[model samples]
Target: MVSRRGTKSKTPGSKRTSANPPSRKQFNPSLHRFQERYEQKEFQAKPHGIPVRVLSFMGVTVLAMSMYSGYLYASYQREVSKAQSLDVPRDVSDRYNSTAPTFDAEVELSEKAMRLGKKRGDLIRLARGDVLEVSCGTGRNLEYYDLGERRGTDDQGHAAVIGCRSLTFVDLSPQMVDITREKFQAANPEFTHVAFRAQDAGAVTVEAPARVRDLAGAGKDASDHRAYYDTIVQTMGLCSMADPVGTLRHLGEITEPERGRILLLEHGRSHYDWLNRILDNLAPLHADKHGCWWNRDIGAIVEESGLEVVEVKRWHFGTTWRYVLRPKILCGEKK
Candidate 1:
């Protein structure tokens, strides 16, 4: 089509002939608003960067754990080396003397250390007649002994206040002996049949204040020390002894055969292989510090002592044992 005044009027849809026809409105308010918004979003949207606080926390946690692990390893190594050079320390008596007052508190430091509550009561209940407690520390067992209603011989050899014929408390520490005497006196005020001897349990010969001779009278052979005490009790004492095996052997020797029984509440080697290995690794440290072999096989020790184990109840991965032992019948004493 052609315009009235022009040679050929371009159609409305026709392209512009000018080299730089007015640029398409240079800017449209509405469209420019949208374009500015898009640019702003692009500017605001940042790259996936980690926060400084998070990085710092992670770094600090890793570093702290690593340092703690290193410190523990160093401390363990030091303890192990110190343990290896020393056989159980000879200052056990001095150690107990200094710490006797706080021994119970120290034992209570860990709930697991209680070994399934106060087994001392159970220990004392098993005693009867003439009783001898080896390594009776602080007389903790005195409060639990079933003294019964049978009165002991008084100053005039007449039955006075009711209780066992005699209860002997023995220990290596003088402080322990003193504490035991004090506790025993308080517990059995009416009964004067209690004796406290501060000496090594294994070395207790006729010199030790034992009731065997008094109870046996003059007719009984003094050499027959085993016939004196009817019951022998030990709790947690075996572990710390300078000679657990020998002391146990002596205990067996002194314990009466047939009717006599020995009750023990102790802690030692774990039954679990993994835990036993850990106990073994810590054995030297335990022996050095606590004067006891934490990894010793309690069952094995009892068997080795020539005591016939009647019943054994083990707990805490076999680290704790409640043993009922009796004297093995000698070849001559066998029926």
Candidate 2:
């Protein structure tokens, strides 16, 4: 210790004595605790253009997905081992009668999000003289109909106008058909040639309609162009039909043989196996709620229908189908 006179002192009680020395930092018990961290798994990790938090999240996601896949596999095995029993048949049309009023509200948002209107228009615009639209629920495609006079002849070589020479709407649900009727009438008050039938499309022998042009008669007979339809259209109808293949075949039989077309837009199984599996698992619940089997093999159904495929296209991982078909009998070769 230095005295006030700045002289060094050797006293035993001096503050600067070697016994106390300079005050060292207070020893912390936690810092002094013994540890054996020579190396660790985390320490081995190094930057490889990806962040550590991202890598951790990726690892967790992979683990969770693996566990989920295993669970699904086990579920499938159990399902396969289960014995078959007589299940009560489902009639989706009956369900549609109840769903008629709010059906558009229920599905419109999702359809708009998916841009389904464009797909519907694509099929509806291809229609020609004496068209039959089977299972036309709530007239969803009515607005899509280009009502301006058609300047061209139909596939069957009949003069056509106002989108079609005549239009027929059919559905199994009376309520649904009624709604369709109201919609069409409100939109096309001047067009009285359109017909609405509340009967199973598969069972009904559709009455041929008078030409829209004939109603005003420019000296033409009402039945001048009366015959089987020049074009048959069904959108999202097959999945709910009890006999899809038979119904398609029936429609083909009623279509004008050589030049008639069947335009269909439907939803079903996907192109990928994984997606198909998911669809199959979800189908029963979907059918119960939406009255449609969304996982049916549409391509297979069309093949079994035995119609000549004029054109076939798919979208949304092949779950959505757009088809143009002709009668196989007269149109022996696809054009």
Candidate 3:
């Protein structure tokens, strides 16, 4: 029994009701039949995360790889110490020619993962006056340059406003050179002082522009201005070289004796022995597939090259090397 709106009906066990009561939900036979039931479920006691067998397999795999790496590490290290010229399975040029088309794609993810662009910019921004890039694969360092004629210091540490300049790129792989030319020319059609050559950088030469020749003192009549490069760059090149030391020496010969710099970003033996071991173990297989003998000690190569080290930086457990080198004459030994 309930009380009416205005008149209170005093029934013995009566209750008051609202004028507008909530409507009751209508029952449906189908919904009631399929309604959720709440009951205690058996707790799954199965171990979470990776299965025990899978974990065991993974441990075994790691142990096997480590054992394998340890076994080969010493022998491979000895072989790299020898620095054999023909250790790589294929000649550098032919290897790169076959791989040129897919080269950028192949390296794109790795380059980004390694953050090589910033490292590249750190070196390329220092390029001023006439520039020559050897092993200029796909012109990967193109966007990093502080391009155009600009004022910068010379090799002897003197501030000089050098004359007309040029940017020349050379590589042994003709296909790679063609690809580099296409990318750069398409991007900078207005810039005219650029040359992309597919040739041996160790023996190749580039004629200097009038202003560059004058700045370098090549004289008005000197037909070959080969030694006019103010900045020489190479990245990831030494690994593929038959004689990396000799090649670096040739680069030193062409660079300006007073103010030229050789900027190199290379991968090689690590400062840590364990890492060097890994690099050594992977060396032969990596070379056969990629044409890169990546375990050479870059410090030894540079020392043997006869170039004076201006600055040196290493990254990735000392496996990556960045060197700013100059001709030995810049050390100021009186002739």
TM-score of each: 0.66, 0.68, 0.68
Candidate 2: residue 215 lDDT (0-100):
23
lDDT of each: 0.73, 0.80, 0.80
- Model 3 root mean square deviation, Cα atoms: 12.6
Residue pairs clashing in model 3 are 154-259, 155-258, 155-259
Q: Which stretches of candidate 1 lie over 4 Å from their true place?
A: 1-74, 85-94, 111-116, 149-163, 205-226
Compute the lDDT for candidate 2.
0.80
lDDT of 1 at 240: 75
Query: Tens-digit lDDT track for model 1 on 1-335?
Result: 66788678767798867777575756679998999999999988865478888899999999999999999989978876776776666334446777788877776656346544566666566677778887888776676776653656644776644345677788888988898898778767887666778888887653233444333443445454434467788888877776677888887767666567788988888878988877777776776555566776788888888888888888777888899888788665622
**Predicted candidate 2 versus true structure: per-residue lDDT over 83-169, tens digit per residue:** 122132455657787898999999999899889999998789888777889999988999876553467675688775536778889
Give the TM-score (vs. native) of candidate 2. 0.68
- Provide the lDDT at 185 for model 1: 80
Report the lDDT tens digits of candidate 3 across residue range 7-125. 65687677877999899999898766555331212234545578889999999999999999987877776665654433555345467888889999999999899899899988887
